[model samples]
Target chain A: MDVILLQLLNGLDKGSAYALIALGLTLIFGTLGVVNFAHGALFMLGAFCAVTVQRLLSISFETIDPDKVDFLGNPAKVKTPYVESWFGPEMGGAIVDWSVPIAILFAIPIMIAIGFIMERGLIKHFYKRPHADQILVTFGLAIVIQEVIKQFYGANPIPTPAPDAFKGSFDFGVLLGFDPNAVIYPYWRLVYFGFAAIVIAAVFAFLQFTTFGMVVRAGMADRETVGLLGINIDKRFTIMFGIAAAVAGLAGVMYAPINSPNYHMGMDFLVLSFVVVVVGGMGSLPGAVLAGFMLGILESFSSMNVIKSIVPGIDQIIIYLVAIIILLVRPRGLMGRKGVMED
Target chain B: MLGLEKKDTSLLIIVAILTMFAPFILNPFPEGSALAQFNAGYPDLMQRFVIFGIFAIGFNILFGLTGYLSFGHAAFLGIGSYSAVWMFKLLGYNIIPGIVLSVITSGLFALLIGYISLRRSGIYFSILTLAFAQMSFALAYSVLTPLTNGETGLQVYNSDPQYFHSENMPNIPHLFGAKMQGTYSLEMGPWSFDFNTGYYLCAIIMLGMFYLAIRIFRSPFGLMLKAIKTNQTRMNYTGLNPRPYTLAAFVISGMYAGLAGGLMASMDPLAGAERMQWTASGEVVLMTILGGAGTLIGPVLGAGFIKYFENIFSKINDTVLHQWFAFLPDGMENFVITIIHPFVGKGWHLTLGLLFMAVVIFLPGGLVEGGQRITAALRRRAGRSGRSGDDASSTDTTPAE
Candidate 1:
């Protein structure tokens, strides 16, 4: 029971990430009818935003310290960050420690702006083209974005540590009435899950309760009818694109400490998130989230020794196998509507 | 000529002339010169040009004709490589058996994948193929390590059985007695050219495949595939089943990829799982699109263009950049090198990405269309000038078509 619970906890963080990215993909598919292959690059850019924030906060200037002597017998030099000098050491130190969270504030606007530019500049032109062309153009954009990031950050993964306060692991087993050390979950992972839940909820609420979202939903169902009603559905759809980008960006910002931010991390997540979206039924928001978490748990479960013993190397290919079987059996996916991409 | 149309015969002859004289044509730069770094006539790179040309041609047969974009084609290439290497281990280093086995195996594998993947179309088909490819990659990388050799990659060891081995037979891959690596270099006053046995073998095979592709393009079967691309629903309404035609194209292309992979292994006797990665599959798609998909000569041209640029662009570094800009003032040279630094060497992919986007957006028909447009414009100019003279009749007889 403890092992099962532990694996479930383990699955949540990764599942949250998949759900977040798939949600964004489905949103763009639903609204703009564009398959944005570069969506993963957006997730990657969000992580880099955190890296950028940390680097910015840590920019230091050197000053001579007369009281201390160096190893060379000269006066020691102290390097103090601009943040430390401006806000005083304690507050500035706290701010730097919390850079990953601080990045969310910066990433939202930046990611939305990027989404706007991408839609207006590149994706906007591909609306009337074939799906293959849309995929090809966006794929090119993904490669360009990934390469540009690699050029700036080099090819190595950069570790972005979480704030000091959330550094330690929590004893979940004791709370669940199991052995003390059976289910030791990290504090940050719990925080990530909560953050993901809030974001997912907020997006749902925005789409459900707001008049703008209602218009966007109407546009998704029938763009011509919405346009015929004299609603500026295209403009609203673009805003929806921006919101989706922010959601994906937020997912990446929170995920930085879990996995080191790397240039190719986006591509890695991209293939899996795509499978998640397809399995959940394309253009279905609730289906994407549910499928993401389910696949994440299944992936973790398959990686267990018990499962591996039954089917050797099952862990590496379980998701793909499931995806294939699901695709073959349920062509439209779990919640797919009839005639949605049926052609 | 050779059962080909007049235009196709000329195109075939042109391709033949180019491949046959490649060593001379590609090595235009003199040996040990400042521009020598740009030459791509070496045995290894030449072998790749033809091998990839075959791969792209096969891909075009499926994607260009049927408009079914598959993202799992690299899995066939990887399977071909692994089977070829296995053949080398079980039998002798003779490439004939390895190449044959590779085609059969990859064809069977493609039949299986295509049967399932062809059930859907558009993005769903792409994602399905992508999933299968990734699954194959994962399995090859780990679960099937005994067969694939995992991270170390599959290579023939001394202990492996080679039933056809003999003292007189070359240990490395060979055709009868001719070693694949054997090269004859000709050195002139300032020019040098390398004629490699492996390159010639690959070039001949590529030409055979190219001819076959041309035949396929002109056949009634080819028209059906093109019809499927145009409108499958209408074809279905016309009482034609598109499934069998698409599957055949998919399998044939898979065999082409396998042949290329087999040739690759024959040249260098090693098979790695990385060859099956989706990025490698993406490379073939890029080649077809860049050259102009559906055009007869486009895939070969695109393949050669990409491979040649990849070789040349990656070789350039800061020192080479500075040397080229030496005539400029020191500060200006430094500035130029810094500006050009990101688009060369390690940054070659960035340039490739931007180029791909520009091609997709501005020139959807690819380089072939661009060439045709330029020729048409030149003809128009000549026609305009000739209209003022007595030669106007000759100009009017030959329209731009």
Candidate 2:
């Protein structure tokens, strides 16, 4: 029972990222009909925002202090860093320490600007082109984005840790009347899960409750009809594109501790997210979140000792196997509407 | 438009003959001259020309005729390469048996992949094929280390269990005049030529494949594939099954990829998992598009252009740039080098991306369309001076596509 709860906790954090990414992907696919192969790159860019901000605040220049002391017949020089002088000690250290949370403000405008430029520059021309053309162009865009990142950051993964405040794990098992260490869960992971749930809820609430969300949803249902009604549906879709980019970006920012930021991290998310979207049924937002978490849990459970003993490589491909089965069994997916990707 | 007649056909034949003798037509560069770097008449680049030509041609057959954009075709090519390398390791280094084995291996693998993937169509089909290729890549990277040699890649080394022993087997195979960079140089003052047998062998094989592709394009099956591409649902409604035709196209293209792969290993026996990767697969698609998808000759031209650019771009350094800008002041020369540095070598990809965007945006029909537009513009200026052999471009990149 304790093991089950611990694994469940583990699954929720991973599932949060998948749900967030998949939700953003479905939003773009549903509204724009572009598939947006570069969404994963957007996600990658989100994490890099954190890396950039961290580098900005934490990067320091070493300087020799004017005062010197001699000890044991050797001249000793005091060492200092320029950041202390620039940001004034405590505040600078705090800014550097809290780069992850600070990146949220930095990531929003950066990601929105990126999303707007991408839609305006290349994706606008491909609106009437074949799905293959959309795929080809977007794929090329993904590669270019990744290569640019690689050029800037190099290929290796850059580790980013959660702030020091959330370092320790909570003794949830003991609180639940079980052994102390049996169901140990990290506070940061719990925070991540909570954050993901809040974001997911907020997005759903915004879409389901607000006027803007209603218009976007209506536009998704019928862009032509909405445009005929003189609503500036294209502009709305563009905003939705920005929103989707922010969602993916935030997911990436939050997921930095889960997996270190690398240029090729986007490629890894790409196909898997596609599978998640397909399994949930294309254009279904809720379905994407549900399927994302479901696959994530399945993957986690498959990696367990009991399951691995039964199937040697189940963990490696459980999600894909589930996807193939779901797709084969129900071509429209669990919550897919008719005529979406049916053509 | 050449009246679609015999006189135009003769002109095309003449052009083909000239292209075949391009080595003789090109001005020879002096040995160790700066211009020597630009001379792609060398055996190494020639081998790539034939191999990638075959790869692009095979891809064209699928994407061009069927309009089924497969982004994972390199899996077959990689399989072919692996099989050819195995043949060389197990059998002798003779080209014939290795080529035969490669074709068979690639064919079988393609058939299997095609059979499974062809169950879906459009985006689903693309995704399925990509997934399968990625799976192959992952398997090769991890579990299939014995066969693929894992990250290190497979290569020829030491003694094999040769049935005829080492004494009888000549290390490499040869055919016609050209050899695979086997012989160094036959110099004549400033000019020199090295013959490669493997390249000649590949060239002959390519010629044969080209002939086969032309025949296939003219066949009933080819017409059916074109129909499938235009209206898959309509074809189904007409009681014509599109599966067999699509599967056949897939397999045939797969075999072509395999043949290219076999040639690669033959040139230098090394097979790596990277060959089967998604990016590698995507490169073939790029080659096909850049050349003009459906056209027979376009893929070869595209392949040559890409490979040549890749070679030239990778070779450019700051020093080379400075030499070119020697007339400038030292500061200006350094500035020029800095400006051009990002576009050279691996950075050549930046140039490729820009070119790709330009091509896709302006000329959706690819290079063929660009050529036709150029011809049309010229014809307008010339005031119907000569017969327009430009019908080839229109036939290749039909606006209806």
Candidate 3:
């Protein structure tokens, strides 16, 4: 049915975001053994990176045009973006139009640097503390980060529109022999899903093929043994933390157009992403991705009219209900190893 | 006195005196003075101080004693508020019935949630509780709109069934005929003090709850709870099931949260779903930790400290900052204001977050421990100067685990 297909498409963008955030959370938890409650703040910072890029590109200076007259019969003051003047109107306009993509490049290093500072400055000291303390400290950091963002951007959601090319929806229903409007999907959302798939694949490949990844995986399994083997496993773990931060940041950057970048968007996704990580089995990468998509689809399905009619307001609480049921039924999560935070 | 230990009795008396003379103690600054902005002796804020103190004390009973960090306690508080408002709608504006119903309903809700959530410990327990709370919040915000009144919140209306209503009864929430909002202000010279009936009622309740907390801390059951915190595995091996003890603590804390919520509704006569948000739950946790979790007087102190700062800090703005720094040179004043601007008013949460992190990192034992450390250092100096350090070392008190 077109409805089912449409729902699946509806779920993918959100699912990709959940997968991306949960993957990062699991990475930090796996390598550093720190529950970074501020992980959502990182995702938020990534979206802000796109906002920053767009703002930077559109920096304009006003000039009086002698040929044009204003309504008051004075020479018109025309504003031209610095980028337009520097690169010529056509090229500069295109660059500005694609600021969201341009932000991906800018966000990577910035996010990684942030990750490094966060680990080295703050989270490094909390390694031997209780999990509760880690959570508390990170939670404090999240609040601080959120407040800082709110201070800068104000509390309102800033719309970060995608490129002009990706503005409209693609009629998937027509391609699949259904009516034109039946399976309509946004172009940017499809791009987001494809982008997520590539990133997930690249991360998997890097882990599977690289020696550094092997060492990190070994360290994850047994830190002491890796340390005993003369490997600087701690340093590798830190880099992995940066990578995880980059992944989450990229997710945020791409997600800017789908939903306006709000200061609290990170927190809104955070609770659910955490649920995703737990349901996927903590420290399990594949499990995080699978659970992310599963929950996302389930969420969309619950929001369907038929489902809502049967269970009123099911959409509001379906994710949490599923998380609760999953947590209760499968205590260790889907792919969690025995004795991994079992106590 | 009152079946309390000597130290606890003194602490209780001190708290009683402080509450009794709060209008004076809290309003040390005279009316219309530069420091008047810092005064928190108003009925609304003073009421909040005791109400939140009760919530934190209850939280401490669970988290401080058992080391089980719950992140869903606000759900109980919200439930209490809703139940209390319902009582006001059904019965008259009497707070007694509302308060009772709130505690009962929240207790039952906590029992159900605790029974399910207590199956796991550590982060899982926290997440489970959080999920349940979020579910409650979502339900209350939407489908349960009829019960919760949705976004408009639950408030008493003229058309509401008030079977016990009388023509002579006060319209506002009251105890018999004593209005909760009734405040008697006394102005003398430059200073003014307000004696609020609602504040006194809340203060009395907070003191009673504080006393109960102290008793719980000192009881055999308290020791058992601490033991569970220490090592549940060892307790299990010793033939003791920690589940029942933990569930009881959870229920008790939930009831405390509910009582606070009920009190809140009784004072304001409205209940909203935002009260159930996780941030509200986190506020209680922050209060307990910032005060010194597990310490008898810490939660109350923490509650007061946070509430006082939140009120004072939020009231400050750019104009207030300029007034304070007007004596400085123009450039210097501007610089100072710029530096201080981000940590006040709308930026209060930033300061709170930074302070919370610092407390967690540098003073895990919280403000109580910090105070104790300072006193010990001062006594050491005094002893060294007076008695050649003979009793200085012996006077050093180790923090309670």
**Tens digits of lDDT, candidate 3, A159-197:** 999999999999999999999899999999999999999
> Where is model 3 more than 4 Å wrong at Cα?
B388-400
Q: In model 3, how large is the Cα lDDT of residue B359? A: 98
Model 1: residues >4 Å from true position, as ranges? A69-73, B387-401
TM-score of chain A of each: 0.98, 0.94, 0.98
Arranged by DockQ, best first: 3, 1, 2
The pairs that clash in candidate 1 are: none
Fill in the DockQ of model 1.
0.90
Encode model 1's per-residue lDDT on A1-343: one tens digit a residue: 9999999999999999999999999999989999989999999999999999999999999999999999999999999999999999999999999999999999999999999989988898999999999999999999999999999999999999999999999999999899999999999999999999999999999999999878888898999999999998888988888888898889999999999999999989999999999999988899899989989999989899998999999989888888888898998887877777888
Global Cα lDDT for candidate 3 = 0.93
Between candidates 2 and 3, the one scoring higher on lDDT is 3
Give the B-chain TM-score of model 2. 0.90
For B1-401, candidate 2 gives per-residue lDDT tens digits of 22323543443455356445545433267768987767766777777887898899898888888988886798888899889888878876766677888889889988988887787777777877777787777777766788888899988777666443356446554222233547555678887765556666677777667667766765788788889888999999999888999999999999999999999988888899899988888888877777777765667767878888888788887778877999999899888888777778667776776666666666666777778778878777666676643433344334324
**What TM-score does candidate 2 reach?**
0.91
C-alpha local distance difference test of each model: 0.92, 0.79, 0.93
Cα lDDT of model 1 by residue, B1-401, tens digit: 98987777888889999999999999999988999998999999999999999999999999989999998889999999999999999998999999999999999999999999999899999999999999999999998999999999999999999999888999999999799999999998899999999999999999999999988888899889989999999999999999999999999999999999999999999999999998999999999999988888888989999999999999999889989999999999999999999999999999999999999999887888778667767777877886532332222112111
DockQ of each: 0.90, 0.41, 0.91
Name the docking class for model 1.
high
